[model samples]
Target chain A: MTMQNKLAWPKKITVCEVGPRDGLQNEKVLLTVEQKIELIERSVQAGAKIIEIGSFVHPKAVPQMADTDEVVKKMKRVDGVEYRALVMNLRGLERAEAVGIKKAKLTVSASPTHSLKNLNKTPEEAVRGFAECAKYAAAHGIELSGAISTAFGCCFEGRVPLEQVISVVKCFKEIGVSELSLSDTTGMANPQQVYEYSVKVREQFTDIDWVLHFHNTRGMGLSNVMAGMLAGIERYDSCFAGLGGCPFAPGASGNIATEDLVHMLSEMGIDTGYDLAEGIAIGRRVREFIGHDTDSSVLRAGRCSDIVIEQ
Target chain B: MTMQNKLAWPKKITVCEVGPRDGLQNEKVLLTVEQKIELIERSVQAGAKIIEIGSFVHPKAVPQMADTDEVVKKMKRVDGVEYRALVMNLRGLERAEAVGIKKAKLTVSASPTHSLKNLNKTPEEAVRGFAECAKYAAAHGIELSGAISTAFGCCFEGRVPLEQVISVVKCFKEIGVSELSLSDTTGMANPQQVYEYSVKVREQFTDIDWVLHFHNTRGMGLSNVMAGMLAGIERYDSCFAGLGGCPFAPGASGNIATEDLVHMLSEMGIDTGYDLAEGIAIGRRVREFIGHDTDSSVLRAGRCSDIVIEQ
Candidate 1:
């Protein structure tokens, strides 16, 4: 059978680097502000147009991100690159706006069990909190992108209902949040689920910007990306060195490696606007800085175009 | 915006275990004959219908597979599971038949440069050798499967043209070989290439069985499998513990992990008739036997359905 008409892939995609925020928060080592700044700057040099620099949560809660404020203060803002921070509450939003962060991402868990455990709030309470933060950020001239965590499935509540996720997205929309992200917090999504759910969500939220955040847990990260792309998603979140796992999800691996994702996308004739080699180098450096091996495959296996030169 | 019609995935697939041959050939450690027998037995227990037990080559060339004859001799034959060995020439076929091996795989390189470096023959010469082996195997009541190495791309010759690969397939068909496999020897294949090439090959060889062997060299192994499935191909080759890399390609990684493939397939609702947990256990054992970490993500992340119980 002729399959020329079956495959429909996007020609271009926007990859957001989330290594400095999500990656570092789950890391054991506490990078200094300078190191965090270096990572963000290097990510920009690697052609990342958007970087999630840090999260504005309580320092005592996540000590690894204690210097997030300082890191943002010292970071070199490159032209045309949007540096965003994650804000959980109104206080976090205030701190981000004070630091001159123009774009802030507000997240709430879709599953009540995960929300209670991670945020000490029910799903309703978390959504209410996000509503307050969204109002504050919008009034303060900050662009807000809302994220629904555990959108695919939750560790505490296995197989989170798609109805629950749709409700959360509806709440985000009700609160005037136009950009939204669905996070596979436990990496429990398969390609079919991703494709089916994304198709439904996109149909429901016709005007919102849809972003996908997938974990490499169970090894379906890039496959989920492909499914999302086929479902018409254009923005994705990845990390350098495949760093970061959900602290609440046991045995979770990192986010998809930025270099690995870029390598596949670039080879498939999709434009990612990132240098795969440069991303690999930064991933290696981050691995060294944290004194741990990363989950990146591209770092271990060079690019497909790499010529094997014999000595 | 509704994409429910574009994606076409197969409902069932056949996975062949090749860790015993392709996986072990590039390993530093050599398994005892008993250990090799146990692995093959475990693969059968894990629902592998076909297992490549060993390769009949010169012992000096690949010492890791030196005990091929002993392994086939001592292995317990399981009903419904077909055990096969790799035979490169008429002599190798004779050795396999002498040991009462019922099925054998004959391989030739599609690229002349790789054929010279790997088999010390031109592409035509290797095909001629495979033709001879096919004749002998057919007459001796042994089922033969022909594989084209470097069928996607080659390290020495760069991109092996699709015309070159098609020519090799034509030669295999002319030799009366109906079971054929195309190997991405260097792991240079992308999803688009796999989809397009597989569609073309399936169109030309409507009655032949086609198998895809991919390496995770650029981390596209499982994605390529997805592409192949979308293109209507049903058979794939995977290795336990994601073991094996090309000895000729400097930066090649292992074949797609059997457990990883099974995990994705099972989660996607595709039946491979394999127990994913059992396959993971075998992969873990193989990792211990080799005293090295594997490239399997499911081995690290567990299955998507695994419930993370909070401490």
Candidate 2:
């Protein structure tokens, strides 16, 4: 392949803040609806054009996200910001619609074993089950995206096959999902794998909006983002203070910190449209609310542009 | 530039383990000489060809490294592995000679503010002071390398100018020091800066050995390594368990973890001749000895190849 097509780096990236949904859902400390709304509002103020506000999963299954409906209802929606919710099945879709969620993400695991454990369905069964929710979302005029969890690798299955991921993407395409996200749920992706896989996916699925979600479980999150960006992918999911982990995966860590990602991208001359200092402030506030320290480095070390004045 | 020349990733990399010196020096809990010796032995066993044994700094300034001479004396010597020590002046160089250190690194700060605070001398004075030690090292048949700390950016001075760094490198070259290393003293390096600066250095100083040392304080350590590697720089300084920090630079995290770097490189199809499993084991042991967790993700999340077998 020629250099022009092979090494295309995006000039601007769209960062989707997933702190309120993906971040808080896995935390042991449950935030009230008001707290969740505040986080979403803070993220919007920090230049997050898209925010995953909450998920419509079973309340008992994920009690931390139990206040999803109330949070969406009470949150002051900004004119330009898009608030999205995640849904696993038809019932979750119905719940999202009940809250008047304009956008919803229908997610399934790419690994059969993970799908069985996380969603109580096989990979095929999970995608089949999403049919009803996809239809419901289309009928209600709700913007819907499909997410393939364990798209990079699974804790139980080791490496998920590329063919398997492609098959799932084909299914999502057949179901009329125009936007698709690939998640590194267990943080098992290497930069080379990310680059190669992204190249293939971008080639095959030319029409769909592709998003990359990475966990910093193995410290490859931002590196993978860099690789994906070099492969011409422009959208990524991040959390403030890096607050998120896979509850089902024992050793899983949090998503890439939003501030950390923004810091690196901004330094590389890539416009993220996000204020890193504001993101760090929000991260500090989240740490206080959660009563724990976070995995963010920019929050601790300050931005590279920060000057140190001698006392 | 052609893609082949512009992106010439090394097929093999030389990893210089700096845990025994850099990792332990800044730590609060002091390990016994035996523990330090054991860590060094384990690193050599895990295929570390070059190990920075210790620094010959004043005991009063860094009490944690007071037993450096004893630890170096007690450490087992492997035939193929090269052990090195750091020296700041002729006194420290004499101390290394007393221990019969075959190789020594004479280090000076690139930033004047950091040099004044760290060495009690300006940057120019620091380089001038190393002249006597460099001459002595050469006469004694000791292989000497010059390291420029704060080469990337400094906690006190912010961004150290590229011209300033080039001047220091030129001074080292004039002083007959053939090998040199650049350090991100406060972890302020971004990928673009690393790539751009490395390219400039590699072009200007074509014959000298160049090594990169990074701190993960801002979470850009490994990413910087990747950038440097892509720039055709093969040598790196890493600490087991990601130990080591700048005592003078507040909020600075540890050096990039040895196992983490090896793991990523191995997965990227680059051979480092180090066993990552043994590296992780050593990291865990170091953490236990220090009575704290390390900054390594591989130690917590396991290697990417690890499979979880649920009970």
True contacts kept of each: 0.53, 0.51
The DockQ leader among the candidates is 1
Top TM-score: which candidate number? 1
How far is B217's C-alpha from truth in model 1 (Å)?
2.0
- Note the residue pairs that clash in candidate 2: none
Candidate 2 deviant stretches above 4 angstroms: A1-8, A116-121, A248-252, B1-8, B117-122, B248-252
Summarize candidate 1's per-residue lDDT along B1-311 as a digit string, tens digits: 34583367888899999999999888888888988898999999889999999999999988998899988888889877889899777888899999999899988889887788776888767776677777788899999888988888887777777788888888778878888898998888888888888888888789789999998887789888988888889999999999987565454568999999999988888999999889989999999889987788887777766665653
Listed in order, each prediction's TM-score against the native is: 0.95, 0.94
What is every candidate's C-alpha DockQ against the true complex, given to 2 decimals?
A: 0.52, 0.42
Question: Mind giving the per-residue lDDT tens digits that candidate 2 earns over A282-308?
Answer: 999899889888788888777877745
**Candidate 2 CAPRI level:** acceptable
Model 1 interface Cα RMSD in Å: 3.3
